[model samples]
Target: MASDDLFLTPLNALHLELGARMVPFAGYSMPVQYAGLMAEHQHTRTAASLFDVSHMGQLRLSGPDAAAAFESLMPVDVQGLGVNKQRYGLLLNEAGGILDDLMFVNTGEDLFVIVNGACKVNDLAHMQATIGTRCTITPMPDHALLALQGPQAVEVLKRLAPGVESLVFMTGGNFAWGEVPLFVTRSGYTGEDGFEISLHKDQAEAFARALLAEPEVKPAGLGARNSLRLEAGLCLYGNDLDQTTTPVEAAINWAMQKVRRTGGERAGGFPGADFVLAQLDGRLPTERLRVGLIAKERVPVREPAELQNMDGQKVGQVTSGLLSPTLNQPIAMGYVRPEYSIEGTELFAIVRGKPVPMTVTKMPFVPTRYYRG
Candidate 1:
């Protein structure tokens, strides 16, 4: 690799051997494709696919007051989250702006946390500077994160780990991959039955190879990963969410535990709690909320395109838009006026200065395939 080349994950060599097209994402040279987006996507839906997601940051939080201290910046009821279960949430700024969306999974009574790769450095710095007194945050950069997702993910997983087939979503446990310590979580971004395996960096290659040896598992890339998440109606942090977006407008109110709501016990202590609470108290109408839009034609809409009402009044702009391989249509997610957010509501998208007919539709462009078993 050249001096200016991006960093490579432990699975980089494995991905290269599989003919993956590598690209720079979040400062890491990751695969964007192996076969093709459509093929890779369908393979995952019908079978299983493995993804190298080590670029994401993993951290452990501990101390006497770990859970309480971490909740100071997040809007979720962190303390009440059960051990071995994970919850998604946002890290907000003082003004209610989102710093980043993350996941917190309780590994033990004193430890929990997982953050985004793009913001991990700053997230750690900010958390330490602000809440260091009550908790100690340790970044686990030595580990690699890999995801195996699809309808057959469980079956493929059970080939190595018994009892994995019964693991519920958003849950995790300590396991072993041929005697090597592994932390396997029954969660993924693809909205399918899967697991995100966190393991020693040195073990990534061997583990991935073992999984690929199965007839059901194929190597997937970033292109299919994006499409799969879109099909599942999940948000991409930087594209769908940013410092300017709030959890309310993003339609992620479920992430806020009831105890963290306004006037409830333990309320108004997180960052921008006043603004968030006021928004939750009917003071905010959720005027512009996240919704899916189906374009009239095959013309894929990209970000920053204007969304218009029936009367041609501009309402909002698309945050993340793309042609969904699974749905075989152009699908997009954007904030639209609440009045126009109802399913089947007709709307228009300003595409290249022209109004393209659109309709407000239910999200997860393709129905999610989460394993409820």
Candidate 2:
């Protein structure tokens, strides 16, 4: 890809002015960190942190047959989703491979969808080609996305948009901030209580600037975001999950509603149902899937590290691995055989040609702080 093809988010100028270290990720020029990774990470855990997620794709799907049309593409029971409620789902190829993971919201008049920044273009293009006839798909190119994450996120958002206080997790509401229409969702990727707001791109910089005016709201970047999600036991596409992985093995089997799996009235007519259903019949082969690793040392274990058995036999590979700022120790996520996936199961990681001791530990190395109320 050419440098000219790099995408820029609405907050690009603000990020640069703040001395953020810019890096190319997911086809966009984004901040990897500002004011150091450890400081930003700690700030978010203790208070609120502002994140520019404008690069993510936001779309509106509508038509009289929208729900029915969308059901043909995803496994989620869209017809049952209450208005303004958000549901997590995946877009699968004909072979049942995960084309992309996304969230869909029932907005009374239309369905609002958000997809990963890196996969948005392909996701949008594919949707147009497949479901265009049944539903109208429109990309919200003029919008900007922002995440306010941490324990104090609710309080921060409440002061600005009082309506946010009533919005529960996975729910969204429209509000006004000085006449600027804002869509706030009490949802986030940080494993903490927070909200993701979508608004016009022209208003992003001013909105971000106003949010940062708060002492608790500091600008955070991709580096801290990655460590935060990994610590939350969340999967990062292209690493923890991909086309080769299935929902069952990815530890997301819970996502597949039983009604859809049992071939009820809405049975297994979707893609890859034959093999996927067959696996659901009996004990699945214990292949290496998503698992946590507790590194024995302070040094962080990067991705692609070779994981081996007690006898030095190769078992699996590390996908998303990093040192935890909150844990004060190294933590990693990878795939390992069912036998080796047991918590406390000891294994070795070859880092720089040295066998490093590691053990399987329950993921979300730290407890999640999502609001239960």
Candidate 3:
């Protein structure tokens, strides 16, 4: 893609001033690294790091039928979502394949949604074509997003946004930073105690500058963000998840609430409900299942790497992999045959024409520190 064809965030100039190394990501010229990926990753683990995530798609849905209308498209209990609470949801196709994964919050008068940058265009169009008549969908293109993440994130945010300390994980509320109106959610992709703030695009630079001025906060880029999330065992849309993957196969069945499952009041009302519920009930068989793998050696096994058993028979392929900055070891996520998906199952990842020993392990290579208070 041409440089001129890339979109620039409202804080583009600010990132340039901070010496951020820019690269094209999801149609936007974004900061991929600042200072160094390892240093920034460590800083976020101990203190706090601010990420410019303004490229994400933000939308508002309002209408008396909004909850019901949206519920028909996802396998979650949107009608039961209380005001100020957010839920992770999946958009599935008719065949039970995922279209996109998103976070949606009920903001009392309206529903607030945030989708992946790359899939937002198609996501919007799909929703409009399927459910637009029942609810009003308005894209919030003028909004900019920032993520302040780390163990000390709350302490840093509380200093400026008073009362935010009370918001627990998966909860959100409207607040203010002086005169700037802000909507903040106590959630993030890094599996850390953090908040994702949304504000007017014009105020993004100033807000980011203010946050960066804090002693505990530093500017981090996408490079650190990727490593952080990978260590957290979180899924990246195009990499760890895709249209060909189902929620059950992806090991994300937790996102499907009980209210939408087999015996509930509104059970099996969403798209792909029959297939998803069948899989959930064990009535359907999955060809492969996603699992975490720990490389026995220091070598990182990247995606598309073949996985094999002791007999040298191919079982699966790696989806995402990297040397974890936090764990100081190589880790990866991949899909394997049902027999090889069990934790502690031994396997090999073929990297560079060589077999790297690996073991299927429980995920979140690093412990998550989500604040529930």
Candidate 4:
């Protein structure tokens, strides 16, 4: 698509001013890199980095039946979600395939949700069509989302927004920067202690400038964000997950809260619950499972690369791969037969018609540093 036809975020001009290399992503002209990917990635791991994620869809769900009605679409314990708490969720099709992965927060009086930018349109339509009458779903198009990530994030944020130091991981609350109201969540995609703040689009540039003024914080872009998340073993929507992949197959069943599982009081209420529950009980065997692979050599293996067994038999294909900046070794995530999914199992990634040796390894190639306190 043409550049003029692409959507721009509230921080688009700021990104350009900072010399960010722009690229098309999820129908938006977004920054792919600024001050280099490797540098930004390392900075975020050590200190703090600001990422503009305003392209993501934000919505508010209200009404007395909001929680119950929302619970019908995903395998989450929304009824049990406490105020100011957030949880990961998956939107599923009737066939048990994943539609998208999202994060939702229980604000005392309503629900605040963030969905992938690419799937936002269809996701909203689906939710509205299914639960519109039961709840009020209001899209927040005038808001901009910002993710401030790293070990020093708390310290830097506390300097501007007081009382944010009290929030632990997966928790959030309404705060303010001067007169601008902010919804800040102590959570991020990079497996680090961080916060995602949503505020008026008009205040995004000024707020971002203030955050950038901090000595420990630098501007990061999507390229670094991708590598960071990959090192943290987080899933990227189109790559690691898709409409045909099930939560069980994607190895993210942990997101399915126990209360929504079989034998629980609210079991079988969401889409594809029957099939997902069967997989959980081992009554239905999963054909393939997502696992982490470590390349035996330094060569970087990328997605769509064929994964093979000892005799060159096709086992699966790589979904996401990158040379991890932190580990300085190549790592990948892909689907493979259950037998080959075990740790230490030998596998091969076919690259340039040559087989590169790989082993099934535990994920988060780099350890996650989440602050629960």
Question: In model 1, how large is the Cα lDDT of residue 246?
Answer: 78
TM-score of every candidate relative to the true structure: 0.96, 0.96, 0.98, 0.99
Q: Give the per-residue lDDT digits (tens) of candidate 4, residues 261-351.
A: 8675787789988888888889999999999999999999999899999999999999999899998999999999998999999999999
Tens digits of per-residue lDDT for model 2 on 1-373? Answer: 2346888898999999999999998899999999998898899999999999988899999999888777777766787789999888877766566778888889899999999988999999888888898899999999999999998888888887777888888999798788889998888888888999999999999989989987789999999999999999888888887788766667777777777788568767666766666666654463556789998877778798989998999998888888888888888888887778889988898999988888899978989888857
Give the per-residue lDDT of model 1 (tens digit) for 283-326. 85556788988988888887888999888898888888888887
Weakest ten-residue segment in model 2 by summed lDDT: 279-288
Give the residue spans of candidate 1 off by over 4 A: 1-5, 285-287
Superposed model 2: Cα runs more than 4 Å off = 1-3, 283-286
Sort all candidates by lDDT, best to worst.
Answer: 4, 3, 1, 2
Candidate models: Cα lDDT each: 0.85, 0.85, 0.94, 0.94
| RMSD in Å for model 3 | 1.2
TM-score of candidate 1 versus the correct structure, residues matched by position = 0.96
lDDT of 2 at 347: 85
Error of 3 at 254 (Å): 0.4
lDDT, residue 106, candidate 3: 100
Model 4 superposed RMSD (Cα): 1.2
